[model samples]
Target chain A: MTLVKVYVTYKESILDPQGEAIETAIHGMGHNDINGVRMGKYFEINFTDDAKDIDTEIDTICDKLLANPNMETYRYEIVNAEGAK
Target chain B: MTLVKVYVTYKESILDPQGEAIETAIHGMGHNDINGVRMGKYFEINFTDDAKDIDTEIDTICDKLLANPNMETYRYEIVNAEGAK
Candidate 1:
């Protein structure tokens, strides 16, 4: 089995309202040291042992369901489950 | 400057409806190879150069706004922005 971590974030061109809201809250909290924030989605996928051609499989999944290519970009990292034991 | 990546995920005890939805969708697409999934929120917090005691700052922020500790658990890593340049 493998554990894949996928992170999807909006492109630089898009306006991230949530990120802006957090930035405003930070300023209100008097934490002016934080100039910006960007919010995103993270997924922890448990891929069963039988899954094959893993890289291609994940790519298709990301393209089809995990990310909206028009606005967001995604990247993922896979880890061997056995190594954690 | 520093970049802090905060990952907040549902505690193992809680039911993750969003994750379950994705898992069901995966199965519907004929990818029965995945048995489980957990969804999480990812944040990219950009700390200005003047920020101080970053660890404590982030800790407070996470406890107060970034997560509902009763339902979610969070972990973060601080990285030197300069190092990535």
Candidate 2:
């Protein structure tokens, strides 16, 4: 089995209201040192595959569903469970 | 510096539209075995400190800023650079 982790976040140029809200809350709670906060999405996926073109298949997943390429960007890491042993 | 990683996600009872969409797309693209998908949030925070009540402080950050305890659940790990040695 292959376990993949995906992280999706807004492009740097896009404003993140959730991150901004967290930033304000942090500052309000007397933690004035924090300058900014950026929020992102994470996923854990398990698939049974031992194929060479796995990255391409996962990229297709990202392109079709995991992210909106215009506003969000995604990055992923694949783990080979058997190889780790 | 204290490095913290936070993962926030909806409680299991809550339906995840994003995850459901991904599941449908995966099956539609001919990978039919995937049964479910759950998505969450991840954050990496860096702070400078060496304090015993660091977890409490970070919890405070989570309570007041990083997470919504009512609708979301959170878990965090603290990394101590000095302790690794």
Candidate 3:
């Protein structure tokens, strides 16, 4: 089996209000040294060994359902599922 | 500066409805090769050079805010911000 780890995050030009809010909350808890924070989404997808065109499928899945191209960017790593476990 | 990447995910025993929903949607889109999916949260935090007790602070933040101890677990990697970029 193949395991894919995907990370989706906002583009540099986009404003991440949720991240800012979390940063503010963290500062309130007295961790003043933490200067910045950005929030993102993570996904782990498992594909059977027989799956065809894995790379193409992953990209299509990310573009169609995992990320909003207008605001977010995504990247992924494919690894053997057995080794991952 | 220090850069920390935090990943938070549901514990093994927890049911990930959102992940299931996404998987269903993907299959509906004709990606039958995908067998499993897990959704999680990711955070990138930057700490200044002057930050004290970095490791301890990270643990406290994760325990208190970044993850729910009852249902979620988290892990992080810390790296030099300059080198990471």
User: Evaluated with TM-score, which candidate comes out highest?
Assistant: 3
Where does model 1 exceed 4 Å of error? A83-85, B83-85
Candidate 3 local Cα displacement, residue A5, angstroms: 0.5
DockQ of predicted model 1: 0.86
Model 2 TM-score (2 dp): 0.72
Task: Judging by DockQ against the true structure, name the best candidate.
Answer: 3
The DockQ figures for the candidates are 0.86, 0.34, 0.92
lDDT of 2 by residue, B1-85 (tens): 5666678877778887877877777888887545556688977565555445657877898887667888778898776755321
Q: Retained native contacts per candidate, as fractions?
A: 0.86, 0.36, 0.95
Pairs with steric clashes in candidate 2: none
The interface RMSD values of the models, given in order, are 0.8, 3.2, 0.6
How much is the lDDT of residue B66 in candidate 1? Answer: 88
lDDT of 1 at B80: 86
lDDT digits (tens) for residues A1-85 of candidate 1: 7888899999989999998998888778878889788899999888888888778877888898989999999999888886221
lDDT agreement of model 3 with the native:
0.92
